[model samples]
Target chain A: MKRFLVVGSRDLTEYVNGKYVPLVVEELRAKGHDVTLFLIENGVIAARDGSKAGKVLNGLSDKGARVYAEDVSCRARGVQTLASGISFSNLDFLADSIAEGFDNIVWY
Target chain B: MGKTEPPGSKKKKTQKVAIILSTGSYQREAPTTVLRLAEKLLERDIEVNVFAFEEAVTLTNRDQIEHNEPPSLRKVLGDRHVYVGKFVDQLLRVGLHGAKMDWVTCVLCAQERGVENHQIGGSIVGTLGDLWKFVRGADHVIAIPTYR
Candidate 1:
């Protein structure tokens, strides 16, 4: 089981709507791989309450994949409250994850 | 003490690097970045393989275009190391015909799209399975997907 860190720098409208990165996350998880979704930039909006893409993210979170939103990105956009099951993260944490040797790092 | 070995006794292993470029030429930094990375890798004696998918097919057939001081992608990727997706390349061809790399358009993709013309030189018909094999066999694989 390879470890994967998926970085999302785009918003949900451009990302989940196109069904590329989200589908990749779902498919990788289905294949029994360890996957983490790291949302940055406008991607933080995807994990907020009552968002169209947040619903999909929530489902993915329940399906055994961890979801995180970057702290600064959320704050810059005035997003203080994240949806249930979503957590805050930063690039340092991402760097540490890479230093710990994740098999693959995919940025979308 | 270490034993002295003869020159050329150990064969150097070539690292296979595969890159998937899905963006079109001049769309953004990705198109040029892929070529730059490939050039750097090639300079280090690494084996570079590029798979151009989606709108990136325009890059394979596009003539010399200079934008914002970027090097010519066609000259950088060279002739034999690049591969263009057949379906998109054929659909978007402007008859410029300067591609020097290999073209592997899947038969199924062509048939599904009702594409019958395969007139471009340095082109071939292949399958998704072949591309998968190329990627899986590489030591490193980097995919620069479309921004849209």
Candidate 2:
């Protein structure tokens, strides 16, 4: 399976074209490709417990796509608790992941 | 000052990363995010290529200066502020020693913004060809477009 890394830097409420990132992630998962959703900056808002974005991310996680919220971003925004299936990550993970190689790396 | 490999010896290929920054600084967090990622990537010994276009061409403007904040806003604005160009300059300088970083400012964009000749040292005025070249040669590519 082709590997994909999608980085989301904006909050869900700031969609310019109807939440393109989630749709792209969903499509990739539907196609059976491995996908990792990395949330950074304000994008960590999606990992907050009980938030609307968290629900959407939960759905994607149920489909086997991995989700990670940047630790620094989460702390900066005071996102103390994260929704299920979302793990705290750091830039180190991001750098290592890039070095590991991916078929596609998209930023939103 | 560099070591050369033997005529027939195989040399390890260095990893290369290309970051396309299309947004300007201060207004959004995209520029800061891209810079942080570039630094982290370089620390891993990866060669970084930054292709700046649109308003991003102003990021390396050498005219950036930190001025004293007005008295009314001193509490919030602080006495001094850090400009993004300083970080870009620092990265370029440090990259000279280890994993090299090449920062290219789009010529057309810089000209339109009147920053073509105001860019910091080592900022290359390049065309779309450089952007495509970086993308084609990179082992990984990260594109941060305008967030607005």
lDDT of each: 0.61, 0.85
Find the candidate with the highest DockQ and give its number: 2
lDDT of 1 at B140: 57
Tens digit per residue, CA lDDT, model 2, A29-59: 9999988898999999989999988988988
Q: Name the best candidate (by lDDT).
A: 2
Could you estimate the TM-score for every candidate?
0.45, 0.90
Highest TM-score among the candidates is held by which one?
2
lDDT of 1 by residue, A15-62 (tens): 445467778889999999888888877788888877777888888888
Docking class of 2: acceptable
lDDT of 1 by residue, B40-144 (tens): 444444555566566655554433233332346547654343333333344224223422223454555444444425324444546677679768976556676
lDDT of 2 at A48: 97
